[model samples]
Target: MLILKKLSMAMYMDQEDINIKFEKMGKIRTALVGYGSVGEKMHAPLITVCPDLELVAVVERRQEKSKEKYPEVSIFRSLEALLEADAADLIVIVTPNEFHFSQAKMALEAGKHVVVDKPVTIHSREAKELKQIAEEKGLVLSVFQNRRWDGDIRTIQKILAEGLLGRVVHFESHFDRFRPGLADNWREQDVPGNGITYDLGTHLIDQAVMLFGRPDWVYAEIFKQRTGAVADDFFDITLMFGSIKARLTASVLSKAPMPKFLVLGEKGSYIKYGLDVQEKAFKAGELPEGANWGLEDAQAWGELHLEHTSMTYETERGDYRIFYKNIADAISQKHTLRVPIDQAITVLEIIEAAFLSHQEGKRIPFKK
Candidate 1:
């Protein structure tokens, strides 16, 4: 009788272990808010490809557009409906710049982990409050600074880490495009946090901050160059780090070709042209899997001009899908968040300072 009782207990323990393992491997139900370009093109597809995540629902205000591509995914009329129905374990906010803060706050308060698109929020204080809420609730909060995974950016990071740049004296990054006419969109309109600075500026600034920590002072000139442009269409911002200068600029009227990145160091210089291949692929409706997904062609490689010789340096593979994968791991496997809320707050602080610098026509001292 004693032997039989011990056997029963061992079997029960084994069953419990199996159950725990299965729970850990279960998929996180993800709901995407806003089915705009970012949602429909990037986030939705990436979420679907992540093995540990299931694209369960989406919040579409007007039309049921998501149904065409994601027929199985339920469509919520609004964020409130999705929250009330408890339709998702993770909520991804890909809405306009204005809605990021309020939507993220609502999701966190409703006990759902949140992933907000770039800029996190319009203000640093709002981002901090969201961070506090997530911490108090013991939930994961992240911003989709996807450009950090860009091939060119990653290559720059690798070069910096390998000490190829020696003591970097200057870093210049650009996101210029030739759009002489303004589009009838929220980003071009007179809306809060609506401008090229908030759109492209966020990515460049985030990349700079990731490569080098905070800057000492910021000087900027933000203006509108396009015809009938109410929002800012051009920005040339400089981040001063002691002797090192980082200049980030973007303009819609830039018709001439400009190097995407230019880094000058004591030893040599690295100049790269062309944006990451992942954005074009995503826009082309390509899935984020397969071996050749993020690979950059050798023809598009950057040039490393040294004192005597210049060579083409291959760019690192750009993998934006890793962002979603990291989110899944953070939620299910207890991995640390790659793009934490605090980092997003820091980016917003820099942005605020840049605007101040442009407004007051003086270099603003950096402050936490």
Candidate 2:
């Protein structure tokens, strides 16, 4: 047993060689799972652009699709085969929400670091189990809460840091869209983790939790607004913390322009509209190289209103690639995980609470 422990420690130390000497370090070989829209457009490009990471392999069930863009990468039909081949040091699971738990468990048990797309798992308990496995194996585990680096959120962080928003009191965030009809997508299907509450709600909830810790309680009203919709299309969740309240809402029927973020504080308010530019660039298949990759146009800037005057506050450049860089650093033992599994689990807990709140028609106290 001691011999096996020694071998595991030695292997870990060898992989995290930067901890001993930066000159001997090598790029972390990363494997991507599910070459779907997000995997192809966002994860692959971000991984390729990071200096400390390499896109080495991908798991695709059907045709060799990833080869068109990443020809150098090895393609496997199943994650079991990839693990058998010992192809990569890191596994990125960008598969659908239901597959996240099983795939992440397999990778972690195989002693590979993992990054799961947001919401982590279908249930918070499943996420807790994955966290235990990763901790027992001394592996790096994180969720892809990439929106934490969105331009507007980054700008809000800066504003708070500079005391420009003086003790924020209310934060209202909206993620409305015009898709009144359901697309034939898995997210809108009758699945274990389907609905806007788990889709956009994950991002919105994570952002609120990241900014204001856990809420004291959750009160939500969730519904399937569109006809013939199996999954929920609308939600208005409110998280209360002492004198502050964070309201997060989303719907598929909203057509008119709505405020992306409306923040009120003791001093004044900050109102912002328009989504971050990185997702648009990524969906358009733009490579994440060069300095200007995430810069928001001045026209999309938000407004900060004080008692006497209101001014345009420049939106900070949003960089999704930073998430990959942080992952690399965390693997090298140079930095702590930015979106730790614990945060993701907390997001899941809040989600569960919100659902319960809706079902019971009462404000539910958030479980720690």
Candidate 3:
């Protein structure tokens, strides 16, 4: 372990080495809805950084909380008022899951591009309806599956792309936390889309589908593990894609350190610990600027194990800005949506299947 750790202590690469030239076709007036933790911390900062996106407005019902950080943005009491004022060309819904469908539907009908936080909607049917509306109205629609930009995930993608793992047969991912006490947040309440399944499950399942396409079947055991928690806090979902099996797990009561990702193949395997660093930076209220943005420490890189040897693998720089950048480009017709609404709907369906599987104690088959 000492030798590997010492060998892994290579210099971090220059940020410019991975940076891309952002092309802006046209500036999009973006409005952020729900100035909650995700909206203020993640969505707003990402929107303000993209060269082709302009942060023009925010929607907060009780207070103008967004104004403290983004004073230039117009504050409205509701999505309806924001629409009435015609304040933005793009609508980003970061409200709770229940509001995603209605708000996204309203924005699409208003002829505005829409971006919703993950899960897209509480139900897959609602997501499908939103997709149809976006198609019919000629609007850009995407979900905030921003974890696709996570450094660890980027590393995994590169490893698979290079065939370093050679015909991977098994994959496992964990998003664990140690929050024994429940909070007053909506996620902890007995509300629609109020569980780890809808939260982290959306990200894990989206990443799975993004890499392996829709699974052939799903088996899961999802339940609330906390003592006083009314919402679910633990989930172990298995997504089966023919020869490959992907296992995803998340829990709020977990304390023991677990591998963030573990993969096995015929030739080798990869084991990575620690989560991405971008969220920490964002929560610290750092802007997604400068050359060294999204780069992780060298000591935190994943490890690759072959038949005879093993070494640390450099992680790809994570950039959540890519999401909004693609959104802007799609709106400009310069590029396609990376997190398309269709894929998000599939994730919802998978989540639905997982819940059903948990209830029935059987693997749920996918619709062909």
Candidate 4:
């Protein structure tokens, strides 16, 4: 057992050596379980160019359709088959909400690194179990909370770092959209982790927790705004950290949406509109890199309101590639991951508390 462990550790070369080896290797072996919207649009294309990662085989039930879409890459029908084939070093789960835990558990148990699309799991307990499993198995477990790398969010983080908004007292985040007529996908179904709070809310919540540490108390109200929707369509979340407060909201039925971000402090306030364009560009098959990748349209620039005067600040460019780059660095070089496991666990805890608070009609205290 010790010899096998040493061999695995040895295979994980230093970051620089890994980069050199990757250049020589040409591709890092990888597989996608679900070829749905996220997998086909985001992960697959990004992996195609990532120097340290490669697309080997995909796991799908329909062999013919998987082959039709990706003729060069082999297709396995199940996780068991994929594991036995020695096809990949890493497995990415973009499956339905309820399947994330099981799929990730299977991957880690099989001695392969794993990555799951956001919300980590339906409940905090599930996330905790997965964390324990990953630790015991000595594997890399990561969540695809891509919004952390959003260009505008990064810019806001930089502003905060620079103390532009002196002594932040209140902040707001919105992810409004026009999806009233719910899609036919599983996201719209009534299931564990199938609401806006779990869907888009995860991004806002994760960003809030990322910017500010875990809150002492979380006050949230979730409801369905769409006429006939089974799951929630709107959420108003407030995270309290002593005297400061972070407000987050998202609704699918809004027509005239407001700024994506609003931050206020003793010195000044900053307001930003328009989502990042990287996803749109990514979907359109464009990866020029270091160009205008994350640039916000000038007309949609944010406004900065000083207590004494008002000024408009052009939104900084946004980038999503950094997430993958950092993951590769952590895996190959043993560097600290951009978003550590503890933070992911915190996000889940907040989510669990929010659900409990909503059910009992009161603010829930976060346990240390």
Candidate 5:
């Protein structure tokens, strides 16, 4: 597959073989619902990599910024305007958490394929509503659970898949930083779905679900770890999956951040540090198809332990753009979307349940 050339999974690539796979899929027309950090820094750059996808219009209130950054692209001041313009076949919602449900609902209702950023929606009810609406519309409704594209985590997943870690017993995933000072950003403001729990915690929790499916119960402590923080900043979410337990954590007070992922199984363990380079690459204006896109830096390789042997394993470079590419392919070629709305709803359920658990000071039962 063309993905093989760009993404290596225990195989060496020969150019002729790669091109044959690339010819099978066609390109798609895409629209951006928000022109914020995610739209400009991450999504825009990655869109360039997929030969089958075009970045048609960007929805934003600030026309000047949109015009300045994407001069050749159509700029709409609102979702209403964008939909009226009928600029593209797909709408990607990178808007704030509170707007996700309504915006995604409108896009799907309008017969446009939709992809919302993480957290899916403020609540599971909203997610379920969107899922039903999208199903009725026969449109692809997906969430951008982008961290699964992280190189370290993907490598960890590969290890687990290969039985290198045997049967995983304990897994820890963290997204922490020392952002003691709050930003004027909407994420720090008092808003539903605007907190570390929905922001960083969603990625970790969604990943846990992706690897292990939904848990039977969840125990979480969601609180504001930073002084004067309006929203939650610290959370220790525990997922109980019968025989195994997974801990997904995030903190604003962490000065020295810990490993990105730590997985322990019956046979061995895997420890990884540092976030993937794809985000940095996207921010630095590298295309998703850039040379050596997800290739890991030697210095940032992870460590693996098996039996009495300890070895350093270079993390597979994560390509967040893959999520968009897959979504585009799914839209055009009838391939199954990577992060479906149902999966997104499950993520929201976990998040809401975690919050309820924290509020009630008890474990929350998982509800299908």
Candidate 6:
């Protein structure tokens, strides 16, 4: 009798401990809606690394690409199937720009919190509608403006905050690439929201807005530089904020080395070369966690040219993991969203204005 009583008590205590562990875990089951390069390289790894988030399922329409990397994760052949199964509490839409709106809408209607990639939707009105739906459902709706966490951008932010670059006069950001031949992909195709403006322009514009809120006017020039290209491969956009002028440009044919960021202020100037190291590391299959992760080399630091002197400024650490962690926190009501939907709407508005400016050959004043 004594032995039996001891065994029963042990079992009860073990079960209690298990319950505590489960409660403490408190991980939100996350579902990734696409299996493309950004999804595979950046989103999946970041989601897996977050302790508060679990990558539970994936939406791969044709192939089971996610299974090999995430064996335990269930793979659904379609978003509809995943929704029917109610597999996830959080849905991350990393599909093409065209599908972002419909996919995000479906996820929200299914009562799931959503995280859409940059340019939340191709149109500002659609983004506002998503925001309204999420608000009505009391759910979190966020856009992935991940470049706001870039090392070079963070360094620029710090410089501006500290007044190191007193009274910033001009800001130039470039996402130039050397791809003379067009790749066979949806981005290069002639589709709505298929261009450098929607692809790279979103990031550049978002970063600029983060730094200097909204601009007074937007003037842009967009073109198709590469032969046989149906979509725009080049863009030079200028955002006028009173006296401060921000030039955001990207090109597919530029072979010359241009600074990734060049900011001119009354006191000094900052010029940074090379993209964030984290992106290259991510493409190389490196996870987000490590002692040396997200650190830019000393040689790659931006140079601050001041009156009678110039010195290299240490680049800030870039961590995209913060974006996912914030998402998890926002879902749990522990924190407010870092990348809000309204900001994304403003970005789309600016993108629209840029297109209008390009077509009309005139600068367009911001309405709001």
Q: How well is each residue in 56-146 modelled by candidate 6, as lDDT tens digits?
A: 9999989999999999999998889999999898999999889999999999999999999888999999999999999999899999989
Per TM-score, the best of the predicted structures is 2
Could you tell me the TM-score of candidate 4? Answer: 0.91
* Candidate 5 Cα deviation (angstroms), residue 19: 20
Residues 122-179 of candidate 4 have per-residue lDDT tens digits of 8778788888888897677888888887877887888899998899999899999887
lDDT of 5 by residue, 227-288 (tens): 78888889999998877889999888888959888999999989988878877777776667
lDDT of 5 at 315: 82
How well does candidate 6 score on lDDT at residue 160?
Answer: 94
User: What is residue 304's positional error in candidate 6, in angstroms?
Assistant: 0.4
C-alpha lDDT of all candidate models, in order:
0.92, 0.93, 0.90, 0.82, 0.83, 0.92
| Candidate 4 lDDT for residue 349 | 86
Residues 155-203, candidate 1: write the lDDT tens digits. Answer: 9999989989789999999999999877978999889999999999999
Off by over 4 Å in 6: 1-25
Q: Count the backbone clashes (under 3 Å) in each candidate.
A: 0, 0, 0, 3, 3, 0
Would you estimate the TM-scores of all the predictions? 0.93, 0.95, 0.92, 0.91, 0.90, 0.93
Instruction: Note the residue pairs that clash in candidate 1.
Output: none
Rate residue 310 of model 4 by lDDT.
83
Q: Model 2 compared with the native: what TM-score?
A: 0.95
lDDT by residue (tens digit), candidate 2, 25-61: 4888899999999999999999998999999999999
**Candidate 3 vs. true structure, TM-score:** 0.92
Q: Name the runs in model 1 displaced over 4 angstroms.
A: 1-25
Lowest lDDT sum, 10 consecutive residues, model 4, at: 61-70
